[model samples]
Target: MVRYAFSKIGMTSTFTTNGSAQGVTVLKMQPARVLRHETLENGKVVVVVEYDTGHKNKLVRGWVVDNPAEYQVGSPLKAPSLNAGQKLKITGFSKGRGFQDAMTRHGFGGGPASHGSRFHRSPGSVGMRAEPGRVMKGKKMPGQDGNVQVTLRNVQVAYWSTEESVMAIVGGVPGARGGIVFV
Candidate 1:
């Protein structure tokens, strides 16, 4: 089975998942935001992007979205280095929220605690004042967590199942399940 992308547009690339039972290839040209780039001591490059899949279907587990080999905001990136069955794993630490005295998001005080400590849910002091004068900018506060952009480059692709139109990447990728991960 073979998958064919019938049309081409300079703006966004959208291929259908028809006939071949393959997943569609959709390359969205979005505004390039602040991307994180880290260089390992060994001279490896890591790029991360907070990608978003516009689809409402949240049940799908895995999909590969590749970044162009050379990408500039308005410019389209070349197709990912690998195709179909191959995997690209991007790993990075999602920002962590600070210690939570309350169990709201973490399900802390929802149920009765075995311990009698009534002060079950609370957020420890954000940070000391005056001494630091400011609560450090990157300080972890109980707020929006995860959804960080992490790019793992040159990851090995297990296989590219053309019939399936999917790539299997090894190792764990960042973001929550069903997160839109760009290769």
Candidate 2:
């Protein structure tokens, strides 16, 4: 079973344990409000929740639950209990690097870097000679990079604090700091 929560990406720091350092990503969880409940045909209960209720823009999400009696409408939703060394899946949008070149975007090797070489960073020879004259579709050219939804699976939980409503996971996560992530 999986539980869902909306959290903001916090500062990334290194944690020391057993004389070794490991990078960890911190998340600040917001208290969610139970909006409604629905019973599916499969005999599972789905709870609709709203996060950041005090803000102008609120986020509403629905998660399946095993028991419907545990949740009450118009009440604060309980935070998911997480333990250290537990695996979690986190989904969020990656950081956006705008309008990058082919070399930076697609890892293309350009021509020689000598002063005389004209092709430094351009994506050379994009079309055919005669047959099917135009460049093929889905060409690796310059375009937008990142800012897309990314899911990281099996991310181990480093620590969790119920009083502070913060969680730290081992390794890096997608999206810029302060961005919202679903766990």
Candidate 3:
């Protein structure tokens, strides 16, 4: 088994034992906070950890239970465990650098909003003359943003007695609601 210690990045808590999970006991989590949890856009029970302090700005770290129980905000949970097939590390996603213009980012032309203002939303100049030479490698134009690798760990697991579900995760799980949560 690939043993992993339970831990929260910014939280002031530590756990020596790693959470374990197995079987179909993984299916009950709501999406919450993510850097790039888009890949898991299915109905996957994923637990996300918010890297940002604003309680909204965040990233997708990982999931909650093997068979996750229905989870909601302010729900109590216990620390979970992952064993063999249960432990899934989230991978693959473009990195986000933050903020991009529409024209260059999405590859579009400018439009005129006002009669006097001609340049409404254009990609503008990609490069200068030969002064800088060859449009400069990786010139700041615009394209793609918000997609990063985020991992959740040592999440406190809570019990859902009403549903007979044992895995309840504390804090926010990455991604939007119904997003897939990798082990």
Candidate 4:
């Protein structure tokens, strides 16, 4: 299994996209404020900042920084350097679906409905017959679904409107509308 940790944090500025006449999309990113930061002994840095995503909660996030000392609290950040047609990665949380069954969650084929066999939509025999005496770990049982963080890589940057603080990307992005994504 891949072990993971939230080693750093940083927030992206609020941005909205607009498709241009030249078949390019533009992203308008707003200035963000630095909240707090940490400098690690290994030269890694993390910064927390506030973004303008208009979410119900304060749009605060953290990310690693090249130089943590360059930013102070309450300071507006400058626009990042991104060019048109640049390929970038967007990382964010996927939408959450609270609970699901085997058919929907694990993609199990249900028994035929016409035969009236009662086996439809069940997970079927999930446990072992007492040799190991316990259900195997990592079994494909239905439980909580989605809300996992994922990265969509190689997404092309259509264009950026630094003046307006928004940039448009060329493909589908993760998360709901107005959700923040890391590039």
Write down the lDDT of every candidate, Cα atoms only.
0.39, 0.83, 0.42, 0.64
Candidate 2: segments with Cα more than 4 A from true spot: 1-3, 12-17, 38-46, 53-55
Candidate 3: segments with Cα more than 4 A from true spot: 1-112, 142-148, 151-172
**Candidate 4 lDDT, tens digit per residue, 53-72?**
54456567777877677777
Q: Which digits, one per residue and each the tens of the lDDT, describe model 1 over residues 1-183? A: 111111111122233345333222232222222244445576654443333234443211221224323333333222334554444444444444544434443454344456875544454455676797767786544555444566667565444444433544434444443334444
Clashing pairs in 2: none
Question: How many clashing pairs in candidate 4?
Answer: 14
Ranking by TM-score: 2, 4, 1, 3
Q: Give the top-scoring candidate (TM-score).
A: 2
Supply the global lDDT for candidate 1.
0.39
* Residue-level lDDT tens digits of model 3 in 77-124: 333443322324432233454677866466676877878876878666
Q: Could you arrange the candidates by lDDT from highest to lowest?
A: 2, 4, 3, 1
